[model samples]
Target: MGERANKRSFTQSGRGGRGQGGGAHRGRGGAKGASPARTSALEAVRILRERDAFAQDVMEKTVDVARLSPEDRAFATRLVLGVVSTRGVLDEVLNRCMRTPHDVTPDVRDALQISAYEILFLDKSPHAAVDQGVELVRGIAPRAGGVANAVLRKVAASKASFPFGNPAADAAAYARLHGFPAWLAARLVSDLGAQDAHELIKASNEPAPLYAAVCAAKATPEVEDEVVADLEAACAAPEPVEVDGARVAGCYRLAGGRALLDGRVKRHIANGCLLVSDAASQAVASLVLPADRPASFLEVGAGRGTKTILIQSNAQRRYGAQVDGYVTIDNHGFKTSLLADRASDYGVHLEEALTGDAARLGEAVGDRAFDVVFIDAPCSGLGTLRRHPEIRWRLRPDVVTDHARLGLSLLESAAAHVAPGGMLAYATCTVLPEENAHVVASFLKGAHGEGFELVPVRGQAAFATRVTSGGTDGHFCAIMRRKAL
Candidate 1:
């Protein structure tokens, strides 16, 4: 913890390297207002600290919904996510710069973090970064401006050395260097050796790639080929996007930049022919056997209905008819409504969008068991850190066990609603064994799961295998077959 940053300087014109407090540097060309990206980032950080809010929602409202120009939006997003992702490392660096790191006020801490991020990573002008930090601090809490100025100047002058010794030597320190907690690093290393764990940790900081699922509503002998043709024909991508692979056949990873914004892609999404879905998730949607030619399907914890649409859409492609008694349930009405809307948008119809507790699925469906029941259980979400970086800082060890308990109970509840010879699929977007395979193990060991045989997941990449696979984020799913009559 005593590791110090080596003093380094930066020149203004050069974005990344050395001009610390040099006389030639002038102020920013803009007026007195703080940069919008910095402002939005500050607000987002405050919400994260004080409100304990998720970064995605906070960013959506603070930056994305504001609908700023692309550059501004990108900068704001980078700033907010960078700070949230590297809070521990930033604090560690700030402490090296400050005389009294522990006693630094929240306003000062926030200001220094913003300044440090720019100076260390973004390579903004040290003079400009310092001036802005002082100005922002003065605006918020005038008394802290002096401390903010001095600490950030030192930070700007120092090489941003994230101190972790050799990864193989000290896994805990290696974890700290890469902006993850010691426990998490140790856990990852314990599960997947040092090298793979390091790669996974580093990968989490990068932006997750976008993927599109071409929904099969109206189709033929070669639906996969036809779906790809239609998307390529639409031709609205800013850059040409090549097809990623056919592991799931129906899902295609976005090979180009921001295809979601392209006019053609948006049109396809609007037409219900394509939905932004991950391949690994699509694989889980495919692995479970919905009653052979399933007439009825039940989906519990139907968040935004991505899996619901996939399950039914895939079923339709195979069987030529949609599930007649499709019912999707989630405790939140907003999510249930969203499920309905998204399903409709994807041209996948839902017979029922019921709002109810997933643990009480028996009551919600009421003696009407479906041929296939899918439970995409709530989890600690360790697997999805790429899309949701805030989870790394906010998540804890205890939450895994807690989620496992809830997930298993929900799985148990789902058992009651599976008709004879029916199939039940359980899945989570998390890498931890405690919440995934271990949860299934516990369920199978129990009396409620006595009549079911665990069905191996096919065509999906799991965390244990590796994150190098182009399609997934540590997804886990198992298809189960209930004993037949």
Candidate 2:
């Protein structure tokens, strides 16, 4: 028997899982069998650490997350995401649990982190967590199992009484207690205040359910409701629920994350009536900007064309006219190919889809101008913490602060293509003011932006603000209009 003397069932979480606790009083002899999911998780973590790979991108190539049994898939997803989301806190606890945490090999360290996650947070059986951890480490490192077992035991003995203290009283301390990065913690405190910051830090850890938009470009004007109904029919269990009042008119919410629910939704995505996107992204693409009608529309960084579809839908609604000329641009040829595919799938006609560096817009379209030019610029993804947890660890402070350079170059090049009386809308899935507000402000002050004036994100809806949470990614958008000739 281990410190957790009694067997316990897994905790019921919005995260959704029903795996048995690691298993009770197993001791070494009763340890669980080799877990494919756990093994996959270890490999995923290695790729994330050594290769700096995004979890979703690397998971399929390495682990085949879609093929795992539902329970095992859920478990593996939780373990990898949970560990990455709280690496700082996990390291903090590891230091306290072991005398020389630094001496542990990277393999053992990862295994320990997973074991610690189970013992401290999950409803896993303590003995099972330990046994599985030992087995994992022994398999990976050959000689580290004994130390790994000892460290996790100490962690189990003490994890129940974590001294988180009061979050409102000390934001930094509160952040450390929960595994959030100190820099981001301070920024959250500055942006959201102490209590809300604490709440957000924790809330960001919980994965939001996937949201899809009915591709209005692909379907009739009245197809939104029908699309929603058909998607609901595709669900086999518990019945899909209709989501309404999303910032984007055609958006619907799915209860579970998208990667987990491919059976029903995958085909729709292929044909393009439904597209998976975060609500905030939909809002950034459609909820704001182009306050006036634009005869021609140009979108930069049109990755996969999710936002391109949203932009077109918004333009059609805003102007009551189909844009005369629609041009989509991206720096990557492959992404441009994807954009072309999406455009074809959605049945949206594009006058041109150009592949060129945003800073070299002239090279692609040869000095063409349009009614509206949109730059969904590359950003540090700070505002998207809820969706892209790895960004927190991967991003440097330099990228978040004074972040105007990359987008500014694009903005500078695109400025020449904005017709008089036209508008330029700059948006990013980042909370950093440098990337969002500062970049826009700097461009407005630059040589090409002499007569450009910033426009409100919500037009006449003065009181309406950006959707910051509740299954939304954090976003910052700035729309600026050029003076009429």
Candidate 3:
């Protein structure tokens, strides 16, 4: 995916599967042969390998075009995500099952990996997995069915000793067990220590929770009640999200599996009463807003305006008025257009939505200054792995430091636009120190940062989150104040 597509998918919210429910369709090799869900998943895996496509995008398109039943659709989604996320370990284990792993073609390997994922990770019947796996291989490479059947049977038996090494003693073993690149596993160990790194790795593979933010601009007492009632009517089972023992006022966690597709939920989204965003993301928006409302505001890297609406909503709740001069900038014109549309939907007034590189703020906004400047800088997105499992495989090791360098450059440019005594907020959705703390440290020692001083956020010295299974995605935010002239 391109940068725009990546950001769009990363920020948007929806239900991702957790491998719930099981069954199989039995038949020979042909168009109508094996299970429809499995076949669809196989095709998606092929597309991901050949094109390096994002898993969610490929699966969304595949499921929509296939017209499968709700159960089959869910099954297909789980299979595709599971296979893609666990591919590294699946290959290692499958190789042990074959006498000559090098002889396996990509087409046949894709089939074997799908079945291996089912047998090892999912709680499906081994017999069914093997039978359907053989047929799937036959559908593509008819001569490989025997090889598939033999290898898959071996894979099933070898699951008890999978990972094949002691993870507690070896980082590479842990990486293999979790389908992560060895270098990434080692780096996480170096950065977060072994225990937290293991927790993050395991959590990154699990299903992400569904969250929704109530539109602050329209959240009057009556409107809030109506929206809550609508959520209940749709069986979303909305519950308030709490952080550090305090409830995030307008944020909620949804429990309904079909909530995203419900008519009432869809209507609310269309009318700007609700939006899909993570609790951590909402918290960051809340933390960045000044205690005393400012007359002017600027948001850098504003992709699709989710945070724009969020920051404005928090301001509305706190001051009961919108900032008089609100502006936004993003590298892509299409994203700027999207932000403008979403801002209008949420009843937010933007003074301007400019399209330009934020690394050069002078050229983009012509030396204009704002009371508050927020940079939601782009990074490796390690913290949101649960939502976008494909990233673990696609991200390169050198890219983390490269992103940190770019983040500092953006901060340098953004600092010039912060009015005297105004706030400068920096944020990213990544767990690595290189992109978070290191970037902050480097910026603080730079020329522009000499005029500013670090400040507490939300009563803490600094704010950064850890990825938790069934909890919020990892995020980091820092606040600084420019000295008064």
Candidate 4:
């Protein structure tokens, strides 16, 4: 056996596995087959470093190249996401374990981080993971093999604890340990208060459960539950159980949505009339269901028409025969084609699925035409952190802060299309004040000069208080009436 013992097990987790201190140990020859499996993870990390690809993207691409078995692909993807999520914590550990911390290159650091994640968080044998990491380096960057082997071995042998001690006492420590940027941590702390911020961060780190909204035409909550249970049992990753039936679609939330589940879900999704939707997203669309009778409605920034479907469902039920027209707009023509497909299913006659920038919607649709215009503006998408974890790494502080200007310009464009007594609902999935309240406030200040006045409508108290109280996404909707201009 190697001097460094195997203390973890990648095959099984939770109990009776490695890290019990007395679990069964694999012999020296046991690691031979495992090195190639670990190389999948190394390839993922290398792509992440070289191309700035997301861990999941890299994992998917590498799996195709390596032709990993389904089981190995799942395991490798897990390790990649785990390492990326804990990069800061692992770096702290590597610094303590290395002879000289600053000497480690980014590529080497990524490899070391992969090893550390398996050793610390995953139930993998530290010795095997470390050794495999060294082999991975030799395969990728042959020149660094000796140094990689030595550094990884030193890290695996360390009994020293993490350097940024006591996450409870230090918010930065918690952020670093959990793989979030410092500014994001501070912003969450300020927005959600300390205790809630901590809890939210914890939730954001884990993989989000896949959910489906059951279309009422196909399945009920009872039927959806059985489908979810069957899917969960079929795969290790669980799908969401039917907790509550949706008002529009008979969709059930599932626990998992790994790419493998797509083929499985497709049958149920088509037959059951269910569509994949995040719970948060479904909530946002439900905020305003316009009165059904012969009303002209506009959905601005209708990216892929997810919310448009929600709106149409509401219209289909409430109006039945009263819907005069549905107009959806987006800057991209590709998304408009998608919208047209979805519109066909619901018998919605899309008056105009215009392809123009949101900041110029006023020119596309003449003055004061729409009864309701939903401005689902482009945003940082911070509120959806759980599903889009890569955004944390991709977003810059200025990107969010400067978004208010873009949002304001778009709002200005859309305001002209709101009829005399129409509603303008401005919403974003981000939690930033600049993107939410501040943008709304600035837009209202100028729009007021043109006979627009913010109306204190019922059901808007939650947004008025910045609480998102009605199970809504982080949103801002200001209903304004133009005074016979």
Candidate 5:
């Protein structure tokens, strides 16, 4: 979860050259007649699989450079996200049709994935899907057209039996139905009972909601109303959001989904009048801010400063001023620079943005103690599967354990910086117990946590938000206070 900034620059309208270098087309296949949106979708998926890049980043760059209309841009986005999110299911269906699935080249497989997604999930015509899919495969491998046609027709025939199993009785079947890896599905079921696991799996496949937070540092009393009015005018339908039973002053849910493409909204983002962040993330930032403002604040893993602005915004709304001394530490130098830049853009001041590992905080800032310390520890990002669909396929079981180990180390180091009688807060974007509750329990039992006492967040000892369809992403936060000397 390093530098997990919510930079939602999704819509871009332009006409440019098509993607190149995937071997010259052998003959006239569907590649000649396929929509630019479909071609770009295929290329984006290929890049994601081959290079192991984030789906959003690759899709954004792919669509921006390709020549496509606004409608095509939207369609391309849907195709790329859909294909990437459901890769496991699509491959399973495709493999069922062929005797030797491994014989299919990567590019051809990608084309089939795009078409198969439309056929099974979207309301696409099966005949057209098969035709275009065959042509797409031919474009990549001239001799594979016959095999592509045969395989896709079988895939189209199997559309009714897409999942091909009874999900209610089998974990593997449930994983196949929801496009999740078997290991992740079983793990979720084991960690969070079957019912909650089903709910989470279903929600992860749906589209994530869009949320925007008003930049409190930029919106003064005199101009706050104008900014809100401007945002409403530009957006299709914007609704205010509430967290922990209180209305978040400047937070909104952009229900329309096209607000980011609006010129006014883009201007707002560019000028730092608005920022894109999940509601749960904003809540975690608020939970980190104590009721009584602290004289000094130190933030660990302050990625790209989204949470930094959020914490300071809460401070401004609650205490009417920013903290006097603000410091940040990140393992990456580039991220530290980005944090500094974002803080400046939002008019928040940082006394120091140090580049060092949080696990070695003692070496980074010797003998410096803060009134409040926050560790937004890095984790497997399992809770953000809806927004980062690729993680479900890319993540492994051991990775979650590794992150738990790293999280505990960061917590132990960060706890040492908490002043007597001050507070320390820890958070992660994962819902796994090993990374969230287990880490905290381990910390409280460790020597470094001897003087700290658990403090309930919003009346919960370990506050956890589950992912919901068309709602906030999942998050977890816990707070502790050090005893007075």
Candidate 6:
């Protein structure tokens, strides 16, 4: 049992700057002992390193059950995300300090990574961070304490000397310092240009802004900030601000709060019609319904049903009675049930919750049937680094090609369901051209080209570029009109 601490506070403090150590000390338990929340966060990081789990998924699952104090929960969340964000550089530091180097276990690696991450990224004292890290290891993996302590201490001592070179020119150096797979590094540098690519990599290593959409059904634009503030307050957010509207409308940014889970936050999210979404997700959904006109729509890949809710909310607001029915589909039965449940709550008559693959979903619908088909294709989700920091280290460049192919398959299949004179949209949260424009481009090169025309994304101001500014999540959306056959 770790000591429990009073609620800690976080501040907006600006975008901590590029490649700078923006880490800070999260106070340990104040009275009884260090809270279990702190330990749970540490343990989650360890599990990630030891078990090769995705940090975001691991943290999401762990935080739900950790029974952490609000402050402790926030601390733990930050520690886990920070360590993952800087894992490449942290790994390099650890490798240099190891005696046998290769002898470290996953648990030990996880512990050491947390410590080194704090030393390098946060404002915590190296000695205190290292000591706490060693203690974390002792409780979880007593046998590996000695090795963990030695390696972490060495990391603390040599924190000033880590080297992360340009991945384009030096792939090995890039991988070691940035913690990205070699292929991803090469692709980023190639597509984004060297400087922009490096900046993207650096930005991915930072915390992303947490956002919430005020359910327009319950709130208006004037009250969006109030809703955002109330939710942030309920979550004990260190920093919360209203950034932008969601894909449907009425979205606000809860800058520093955890996206999901937290005793205080769980209540806040459930209380209102707020949907937690990044700006990119909002923007893509917006593109699908850019006007105040009703159209029959089908959403492919409506996992857990968040997007379905966003779409209905948007359509009802913009088109009112003019909006037609929404038919959502996914391969998983559970997801279909989940979507059905959520849609029922929103008072939306989901045309149907069908079970089918995205690529083949068109077969389920008659020819030239849907006015719009939104294929929010699944990909690496690299653009969501701030929220899912651990992904960078675990994501391999090879996955991009596979995802691109899958995305294309889904797009091609989706096009068939799109009625003549209707629109087919392809989108992903990934920034890679391969999974984005390139994939769409390649798909267009095939026979699909004859039937569809690319429709440019309508609102650029609402969109964020992959370089310079750190506004929205990475997303690529291409709308195509189905040619009258």
**Between prediction 4 and prediction 6, which has the larger lDDT?**
6
lDDT of 6 by residue, 231-254 (tens): 566663523332234233565555
| C-alpha root-mean-square deviation, candidate 3 | 4.2
- Candidate 4, 54: how far from true, in Å? 5.2
Candidate with the larger TM-score of 1 and 2: 2
> lDDT tens string, model 3, 1-485?
01211111121111212222233333322223467777777888888888867787887677547756666666777777778888877888898898877868988899899889888877567888888788788888888888888999999998878777798887777788788989888999899987788889998877777788888787676887888888898888999999656678799888744776778778888988888888888888898888899999999999889889888888898889888798999999998998899899988879999999899999999888999999998999888887777888778988988889999999999999999999999999998999988888888898879989899876876688888777888888989999999
**Model 3 misplacement above 4 A:** 1-31, 98-102
Give the per-residue lDDT digits (tens) of candidate 4, residues 96-180: 7777788667766776677777776664686777766665555555677788777777766662444356677877766776678
The Cα RMSD in angstroms, rounded to one decimal, for candidate 6 relative to the true structure is 6.9
lDDT of the candidates, in the order given: 0.68, 0.66, 0.81, 0.60, 0.79, 0.64
- Comparing 2 with 4 on lDDT, the higher-scoring candidate is 2
The deviation in Å at residue 95 for candidate 1 is 3.9
Residue lDDT tens for model 5, 247-267: 777788775556676787777
What's the true lDDT of residue 88 in model 4? 58
Task: Supply the TM-score for candidate 1.
Answer: 0.83
Compute each candidate's TM-score over C-alphas. Answer: 0.83, 0.84, 0.91, 0.76, 0.92, 0.80
The Cα RMSD of model 1 versus the native structure comes to 7.1
With candidate 1 superimposed using the best TM-score fit, by how many Å does residue 305's alpha carbon deviate from the native?
Answer: 1.2
| Candidate with the larger lDDT of 4 and 5 | 5
Model 5 per-residue lDDT at 221: 61
User: What is the lDDT for 327 in model 1?
Assistant: 84
